[model samples]
Target: MKLCFMMLTDLSKRFNFMNSTFQMANGYFEKHEKDLHQLSDQIWDNPELAFKEKFAHDLITDFFIEAGIGTVTKNYILDTAFKVEYVTGKERSDSTISESDLPCVAFFSEYDALPGIGHACGHNLIAVVGIASFLKLCSSLKATGTPARVILLGSPAEEGGGGKIKMMNNEALSGVDFSLMGHPSALNCCTSTITQAMEEKRATFHGKNAHGTTPWMGNNALDAAVLAYNNINTLRHWMHPSMRAHGIFTDGGKAPNIIPDRAELLYYFRAPDKKQLKPLLERAEQCFKAGADATGCTVEICEKSEAYDSVIQNPVLGRIYEKHMENMGYQFPPKDEKTFRGSTDMGDVSRAVPAIHPWFLIPCGGAPGHSVPFAKAAKLPQSFKNAMDSAECLAKTALEVLQSKQLFDEMKRSFKETCG
Candidate 1:
């Protein structure tokens, strides 16, 4: 029989925990489940915005330091970003451990929440999965006498600030072989197997203002805004089916009676990947410029946040992850039915290194993500259970990669093919 990839259909198949390391990893996560739940709750209770996750930053650092699991860096590169490193079997080694001799696996944690809708995206649970997996992986490696390095990166401001990009620019991900993280998703209706490449642009129209009665004397910036909106609407009809373009007029005008001098809008452009997104962005610029030309107004366009590349799904690592998730009782939908949920900074990370950001099912009772209902569901007890399951699987995936050079090379080959 021809096989594309096995989805861990049978518990006794590839996912058998007979491997002592995998078994030990599972035990480690099970023992730390309670602490993981509390950490999730505390972060959920205190929702901080992008680049200001001080509470989460402090809490997570303290958790690692008190446990003595790794060497913790309080403020890593960014104020809200932190890093934890643990070398398995380091204490038992008589000679100095050469970092070059060991393969490194990094896990990312995002703690920033929505502006007002706290934990709407279940980022608190994401922290649990990342940290928990890192800890579990460390424990298993130590128990098995494996020489490896593990890292946990506390990334901030994913809501719109693109914290991962900031870390990438700072070379914070340097020396890491690959990265992994799991996210919670309750939206059963239209969840994508992978996310899209996304970018934000702010357009401003400059014109002269005049009294309401003498509107002709002034170039109405609001008119420019409306025209631009319409132009983009027309452009959408010709856009690629996978591409998405939408925006809101943040500054429509001061008063209805005045011919506004300035107007502003915020729009997002999404494509399957960064390469396709570039042309779409260029075309949108023309639409905005046309709107200004028609009204004899000048325009300025600026990017609001860092651009996010589409995720390069590494099939090799994906199969490793699928094997475990399936063993944990999560079923995968047919590939054709997979839906696009939205965009994320993790997209950028995938392009940089072999990475997986699987969206695990959470108990949201059919509530769409980022909603008040979804936010409430994020803290549900079952949600943590689901989160820990992912953590266990992640650690197992790490163990397999660290133990086999051939597998790591194959994973990297897949990354090259997908990224190239």
Candidate 2:
């Protein structure tokens, strides 16, 4: 009890610091709340799938330009990827300015909607929060001081496009000191746990096609594909509890009577971490080979994208952000009882840098994310306020990261050690 009280007291002091800074700059976000919610709702109304977010991309990029942040590149690393940068320094006020000493903080925004379920994942709120953070930060910096660099990354196709991986390969996030984003969930302060045990790998298999009725006359690739799936299912019981493998039949056959010579299956194998995941993947590959050999079918396996290593949450940064959240009157439940069943490209970022993907609560009576109920809740008045709150919290959190040299150093060290 005594220890808990002391921790809360210290947290209160930090919270007080965040609130003072935010209050002076809150008006900008407050005045823009209606516009923010409307933008979010507009995204909900026009849901676009992965790699095809033309409508979403145009709306958000236009808004960023209107705010004076000018888009840097569109279709940057992918068909729908883009980046917007806003750089400021004390030297900018005078005639002399040197760019070498500025620290760059990046804000990542994902706006792709799920197929057949527009904004069902609340990406609308996600987009607004990113903009809200930029707006508040701009207002705060105008009166007080400016940070080194503020980057608004408009990463598209997070639904399944692996947009961040593409951006990373292009060296787009090279100079970013830290990246931050918030995800809406059933509760606030949902801390992330590092699942360094297994990694996820995507593989696809292909085989020749033939007439279905005269199956013996030609190779039935679909049969070979089924055999591979059965092999994986049979092996599941013998594997570790954490081991998981599943696949979708992308090409079962052309017609019922035709011995479809070509068939395809996309499979994913996950283990606690890369070391364990590697062998499992190799073993799964052998199963596919065996299936092809048995059914007289040819096989082809393509890795969909790079494996996402486990997350490494920065505790110091998390606690600081948590304090700011609690100061803002947010309460979090215990992690053991909370449930988060989805994954993110941010997990890849966490593996590479000191990061945190904290959950903020928006009411749905324990509704699951990416569901119809959650989607409806996302448009509610409360949901918009949560978006406002998320913006304030993330901006305040970024300010803390910028102002505290000691904390900033600790985060960098932690990232090096964890990623190494």
Task: Highest TM-score: give the candidate number.
Answer: 1
Q: What would the per-residue lDDT of candidate 2 be over residues 53-134, giving only the tens digit for each residue?
A: 8887888777666655534666767777778776553543333433334566777777888866577788888888887887
lDDT of each: 0.82, 0.70
Clashes of each: 2, 17
Single out the weakest 10-residue window by summed lDDT for candidate 1: 1-10
- Taking all chains together, each candidate's TM-score versus the true structure is 0.91, 0.87
Candidate 2: misplaced stretches above 4 Å? 1-17, 69-72, 92-97, 194-213, 335-340
Full-model lDDT, candidate 1: 0.82
Residue 157's lDDT in candidate 2 = 68
lDDT for each residue of candidate 1 in 232-253, tens digit (9 for 90 to 100): 9999888988999989999978
